[model samples]
Target: MVDVVACGELLIDFTPVQQKEKPGSIAFEQNPGGAPANVLAALSRFGKRTSFIGAVGNDVFGRFLQQTLIRLNIGTKGLVLTEEAHTTLAFVHLDETGDRSFHFYRNPGADIMLREQDVNEALIAQAAIFHFGTLSLTHEPARSATWRAVEYAKQHQRLLSFDPNIRASLWEDLEEAKALALKGMAKADIVKLSEEELAFLVGSEDVVEATAWMLGQYDLQAVFVTLGEKGCFYRTRNNFGTVGGFQVTAIDTTGAGDAFVGALLYQLLEVGESMLDIPQATLEDMVRFANAAGALTTTRSGAIPAMPTLSEVKSFMEAAR
Candidate 1:
């Protein structure tokens, strides 16, 4: 059985590369990206059986992304190619701190063209975890298609993993975005949030309180809040604690959160879902391991390319300790 099946956008990220020949000019490099795709790739890197379900345009960039995912060991059995739309693209810019800002080129891009009919129920039924983000919910048939997957996962008793990787600018109404994110939380068994997203979702500045509120309000099994370099804070029904981060000089913060999510899901798959309500110490250790993966990802560039293998994450953790 597949350990995880992720559904969402599959696109190219055009990240700026500094030029060596030109004094102050730079060029763009196409990198495979999209939160759910990144998560699947990271899980694949960890040797988990993973698959992705999404649509990409029938253009060259779309083909490239599909090929890249397959090469990364992710199952693309449910990948769709639509001729009606071009592939989605995002232009990413990094600040001095390596934090990223995005300007998307997905005006009716193929990712959003996913329809409920395109979602393969057989593929989703084979997974222990079904993961998704709200980015797919921003438009049309893809929105309903994502919701359909959520329903299928719930029906099959598969764990639902939600990461509200919100791109507010994509939403026509910000309130609608928050509402959709909240709806996703209600269905998720495991919810991953960045510090900012957690605050926005819970309407609080307190990280611990936000985690607690989300778990209780949504009656979720567990909530993990990523705190950048400080690592992640996890709250389960019976236990809660902060995982201390591994030290690293981050070159690009892009995809680090996805790496963290992927690592945690991979560990959960390894340990088995029977003990998901882990002891406090066990949860802390798991988050620490995930933190190492996320940290290592930041030390590199791009999304899928930056993901560390299981051995790399383990080695980095061992050296840190």
Candidate 2:
């Protein structure tokens, strides 16, 4: 049985390499990406059995993503290929300050073509955790399909995990998008968000107040707030703490959150850790391990390529201590 089954988008991220002398000109590097796929790959690399459920185009990019996931040891049995639409493409440009910007070339891309019937309820039922992102909920059939998966997971009494990964450009309106995102959060047992994400979602500048407000409103089992480099802060039903991340020279932070989230879920499932009433020590241990995984990912490049193996994470953790 798969420890986690992730459902959502799978696309290509084209990163730019600028010329040293000619600042205006740059070369592009193709990388396999998509938040859900990154998480699944990370979990698989961490020695967890992971399966992915999503749609991909019949194009070269789709085939490349499929081969990439297989190389990471993620099961691709649930992947659906659609011939009507092309695979989604994200053109990423990083400025001199290391700030990233995106240009999406998706109009009815394969990722958004996911249908309700495409979701395999039985596969989700067999998994320990079900993870998804809000991007799939922005369109028609995929939106309904994502909700269907959530309903099925809830029916099976499995853990529902979510990461909003909100992109303002995709939504019809900010208010409507926030409402829909909150609906997904309500169903999620564990909600992971970056500091900026929390502020934007809650409309607050104070991270602590925003997180505390979300915890109070949603009645969630656990809330995890990731602070890049500083580490992760978590609060459970009755426990709370901050786990420091391993010291590392970060190169590309593209997949850091996915690595951390996957490792966190893997540790929770491996140890049978409960979200209902988790102990403070257990939370710390899990976050520390996750932080190590995230830190290790930043030392490399790309989303799927940078995910560390279980042995690598262990060695890095040992060296940190």
The most accurate candidate by lDDT is 1
Candidate 1: global Cα-lDDT? 0.90
Model 1 worst lDDT window (10 residues): 271-280
* Residues 228-290, model 2: lDDT tens digits: 888988877687678887778766777789998999998888778677656777778889999
Off by over 4 Å in 1: none
Question: What pairs collide in candidate 2?
Answer: none
- TM-score for each model: 0.98, 0.94
Model 1 residue 295 distance off true place after TM-score fit, in angstroms: 0.5
Error of 2 at 4 (Å): 0.3
- Off-target runs (Cα >4 Å) in candidate 2 are 18-24, 96-99
Pick the TM-score winner: 1
Give lDDT per model, in order.
0.90, 0.86
